[model samples]
Target: MTAMHHLTTPDGIRLAYADTGGTGRPLLALHGAFGRGRPFLSLADRLGPDWRIVAPDQRGHGRSDRAADYGREAFLADTATLVERLDLAPCVLVGHSLGGLNAFQLAARRPDLVRAFVVVDMAAELPPHDSDWLDGLPETYGSLDALRTEIEARVSLGEPLHFLEGAVETDQGWRLRWHPDDMREVKRQVFGEHWADWYASDQPALVLRGGASPIVPDDIARRMLDRPNTRLATIDDGTHDFYLTHRTRFHDAVAEFLTTL
Candidate 1:
C-alpha cells in the first residue's frame, strides 16, 4: 500500500510524495514531465518488500506547490532537500526523463547521498525539438473523458492510457495537475548540454533505454555504458515511458541489477 506525506522545502513550497512503507532499503523514484509520484505505485509493488520506495512530486508538479523558480538549480535543490530531510542518504535513485537528468546531476553534486542510480531514457545531450504542443495545451477540459481523449491523441503511438496519470479531476472540470506554463519553463531549463554531470560520477549506474525512443540515441547510450561499473539495457518494444508500458521487463532488469550491487 502507498501512503501520502508532505515535506516543506527550505523555500517553503510544500512537496507531496508517496511512500511504500517498509523497513527495507530506501529507493527514491522520481517521475518525468507530465507525471506524478503515483505512477510509480506499480513499480514499487513489483519491487516487493525489499524496497521502501519513495516517489515525490517535484516542485510545480502533481500535488506539490507550484513555485516561481523553474531553474535547474531550484530543481536540484529540491531533490537534495528531500534526500537530506528524509534521511535517505545513500539510497538508490531511479528517475525517468526529466527526473533522470535531475538524478544524474544530484549524484554528481552530492555523491554521498546516492548509492546507485537508474536513469531511464535520458541523455547528456538532448536533441533540440519544437515543444509547441506544450504551449498549446488547453487550460481546462470539459470532462475527464475529454481530457483522456486529448491525452490519448497526444501520447506516442503504442503508449498506454496510463501515461495520463498526471491528470486529475477538479471542481472546475478535468485538468492536468501541473500547470503547462510551469512545465514549459521547466522544459526550457531541462534542455541544453549536460555531459559533465552525466560523466561526473562513477557510482554503479544503469541506463535503461527504449528501443523506439528518439530522446536517448544509440550513440549516447553507448557512451554512458563506457563509464566504469555502468551498464546499458534496452527494452525492445518500449517507448520513452517503458517502465509503465513494460513493467515486468523493467522490474526484472532492475531486480537483477540490484542483486549485483
Candidate 2:
C-alpha cells in the first residue's frame, strides 16, 4: 500500500506525492509529462519489501498546484525542497522524460544529494515533432472512450506515455492538464542542446530505452551510455509509458537495476 502526503515548497506551492513503505535505501520516482505519481503504483508495489519509493506529482500535474510558470529550474528547486524536508539520505532518483530532465539538472546542481540515477525512455536530445501536434490534442478526444481507444491503438504502436496524449475527467468534461503555450515552452527548454552539457559529471546513471520508442533513439542511447558509469537497458516491446502498459516488465527491470546497487 502507498500513502499520500503533501510537501509545501519554499514558494508555497503544495506538491502531492505517494510514499510506499519499505526498509533499505530510498528511491525517488519522477513521472514524465502528462503523468502523475499514481502510474508508478504497481512498480513500487512490485519492488517488494526492500526499498522505500517516493513518487511525486510535479507542479502543474496531478494533484499539484499549477503555478504561473513551469520550468526545469522550478521543478528542480521543488524537488530539492522535497529531499530536504523529508530528510531522505542520499537516494536513487528515477526520472522518466520530463522527470528525467529534472533529475539530471538537480544532480548537476547538487551531486551530493543523490547516490545514483535512472533515466527512462528519454535522451539529452528529443526527437523532431511539431508543436501543432500537441496543440491539436484538446480537439482530438471527444469522449473518454475515444481517448481510451486512442491509447490502445497507440500502445499497439509502442508509443510511450509522454507522447501518447493527455486527457483527464474534470467538471468541465475531458480536459488537458497543460496549456498549449506552456507545452511548447517546456518542450523547447527540455529538448535544447544545453540538456546534454548538464550531464557532464561522472555519476552512476542507468538509461532505460523502450525497444520501440522513438523518443530515445539508438544513437542517442549509445551516447548516453558513453557517460560515466551509465548503463543502457532496452525492454522489448515496451513503449514510452512502459510502466503503465507493461508494469511487470518495467518494474522487473527497475528491480534488477536496483539489485546492482
Candidate 3:
C-alpha cells in the first residue's frame, strides 16, 4: 500500500506524492504528463520491500496545486525542492516522458541530489507531435463510465483505466482533476532539443525506450547511448508509455540497473 503525503514548494504550491514506506534506498519516481504518482505503486511493489519509493504528482496535475508557470526551470525547481525538503538527496531518480526530461535536467543541475537516474521513453530531442486529443477533451462527462468510453475510443486500448487515474467526481460532473490548458502548456514547454542537459552529467543513467516509439528514434537512442556511463534498454512491442504497458519487463530492467548502481 502507498501512503499519501504533501510537500509545500518554495513558491507555495502544495505538491502531492505517494510513498511506499521502507527502510531502504530511496527511489524518486516521477510520472509523465496527465498522470499522478499513483500508477507507480505497482512498480514500487515490484521493486520489493528493500526500496523506499516516492512518486510525486508534478505541478498542475493530480492533487497538487496549480501553477501559472510550466516551464523547464519551474519543473526542475519543484523536483529540487521536493528532494531537499524530504532529505531525499543522493537517491535514484526515475521518470517517464515529461518526468524523464525533468529527471535528467535535475540530475545535471544537482548531481549531489541524484545518485543514479532512469529516464523512460524520452529523448533529448523530441520530434514534433500532436496533443489535439488532450487539448480537445471535454472538461466534464455525465458519468465516469461515459468518460471511460470516450477515453477508450480516443486513447489507448492497453490502459483506458490509466487515463482515468486523475479523474474525480464533482457536483457538476465527472472530469479530470487537472485543467487541459495547463497540460497543453506543459506539453509545449517540454518538447524541444535537450541534448546538452542529457550530457551535462556523467552519473550512471539508464535510458529505456519503447522499441516502436518515434519519440526516441533509433538514431537518437544511439546518440544517447554514445554518452559515457549511460545504458540503453528497449522494451520490444512497447509504446511511449511502455512503463505502464509493460510493467513487469520495465520493472525487471530497472531492477537490474539498480543493482549495477
TM-score of 2: 0.85
Task: Give each model a TM-score.
Answer: 0.95, 0.85, 0.95
Residue-wise lDDT of candidate 3 within 1-261, one digit each (tens)? 567899898888899998887687889999888888888877666778878888898999899999999999999999998888887888899998999999999988889999999999899998657667775789899999999998888774235655688899999999988888897889899888999988899999999988877778888999999777999999988888777779899999999999998
- Report every candidate's CA lDDT: 0.84, 0.73, 0.87
Candidate 2 structure quality by residue, lDDT tens digits, 64-171: 877766877788888888777877657888898888887777777878777778888878877545555553444445677766665555433334454433457766
Estimate the lDDT of model 1.
0.84
Candidate 3 TM-score to native? 0.95
Task: State the local distance difference test value for candidate 2.
Answer: 0.73
Alpha-carbon runs more than 4 Å astray in model 1: 155-163
Query: What shift in Å separates residue 82 of candidate 2 from its native position after superposition?
Result: 1.4
Error of 3 at 143 (Å): 1.8
What ranking emerges by lDDT with the best candidate at the front?
A: 3, 1, 2
- Compare candidates 1 and 2 on TM-score and give the better one: 1
